[model samples]
Target: EDSIVPAAMYEPLVKAFGDAKNQVSLFKDIVLKLPRDNRATLLLMIDFIILVATNQGNQMDMSGMVTALSSCLLRPPRHLQERISAASNVFAIIMFFATNRGTFFAPEVSSLTQFLPPDDPALHQPYSNDKAEQPQQTQQTLQTLQTQQTQQPQQPQQSQPK
Candidate 1:
């Protein structure tokens, strides 16, 4: 039952963003309100940013992309940054999308790199290491959290000592 909720939430999001729209601000508003713990919401926000950055048509407004990317970069949750850093595929996709359209803001890209700790162990690891490892790490972490969520039954709270 718990597993189904995530899949369910993602399906509609993918459908809604199937096409790019100028209503980027509205999308940003909705994303801001979504629960921080939900991976689907974060993915949806990423997808939305990608879509805006890649849109070839005039309907694709870069302003929205800039706004969304700025918001995400300002103080992204650790999990979301981990997800982005892990997904090399997302970078390729974003580049491909941006190339045909125009170009993504360089500052935004640079800002994202700051998401990682300056001395992250991954930075010291060999560059030849599998690029796919980060995504797998993210998935494993998310799964562990989800499993914990499902297994831990809620307990009624006792009044605390004043």
Candidate 2:
């Protein structure tokens, strides 16, 4: 039961990861925004997909895995017309995540932060499409700082008296 994603979160998740060029960053954002249990469940699901696709590449590639899991993963748009129009986009989003799992799920950066309280000043307001770059930018800045620290010149230590 812990592995099951709640049906209620499906719609909002789809909307949060709405179509755009930078789906991997959006994928990372959605994963981090999830409640603790849900976040664990989703990460497990993605790992499973990657495992299956990798082990059975001849039998099931990323697109094939996405097709197999689409019903389980995606919540269709409510209106009939909307569902018809949105099906491909829904698949595309999932496909993009699957194909670029390395970028979105990089081991060094993939850990989810503990959930923040609703009123926590640090929690970002719900992300908008335009603000999708924020997470990626933050990540880049972190990497740059880490690189600078590692590459900083070590000052020569004066000889210590015995």
Candidate 3:
């Protein structure tokens, strides 16, 4: 039983992300001292969040995950504009999540998005696309919504008496 995924394996991650929601500064401090290798893993985690949201964009609440990633001190800000173009996929993702949830995380992701010099183009992007979608995914999403609606119980309407 213990050989399976361990609770300890996810505890710190949950804690870090949870804390990031309430106090971004604290989350920043915790990750600030982590070695470069750990920081690289953190980047993977950010990518994972984007991937999940893209795949399950309409099903779950990813605002917190996006917020945590934005809050963390991933990389120094400098190549932000360049990175955006390089990782167009990831760029579209965070943007998708931010777009659906309104401008809640825009200011934070933009303000926190920055990287140091010497890196040709690291990664990042958001917004600017009013219409960004793949035909297959859009079709699948619509079908799923239709199925869900049919499965739910319809509410009864009340009548008013004159």
Name the best candidate (by lDDT).
2
Q: What is the Cα-based TM-score of model 3?
A: 0.26
Positional deviation of residue 20's Cα in model 2 after best superposition, in angstroms: 4.1
Best by TM-score: 2
- Sorting all predicted structures by TM-score, with the top scorer first, yields 2, 3, 1
| Model 2, C-alpha of 51: deviation from truth (Å) | 1.1
Q: Give the runs in model 2 whose Cα sits over 4 Å from its true position.
A: 1-24, 56-58, 77-86, 108-162
Instruction: Put down candidate 2 lDDT per residue, 1-162, tens digits, no spaces.
Output: 221334455554556456556545656676666676565445556677778888943688777777777656655445532632335755665676677766656555333323445575544555244677988999999999999999999899999999
Candidate 1 residue lDDT tens string, 108-155? 322223223458564355433467788899899999999999999999
Candidate 2, residue 92: Cα displacement in angstroms equals 1.4
lDDT of 3 by residue, 71-125 (tens): 3322223333244231342333344434432222232332223221235243343
- Candidate 3 deviant stretches above 4 angstroms: 1-22, 56-162
TM-score of each: 0.21, 0.48, 0.26
**What ranking emerges by lDDT with the best candidate at the front?**
2, 1, 3
Candidate 2 global CA lDDT score: 0.60
Candidate 2 vs. true structure, TM-score:
0.48
What is candidate 1's local distance difference test score? 0.43
Q: lDDT of each prediction vs. the true structure?
A: 0.43, 0.60, 0.42
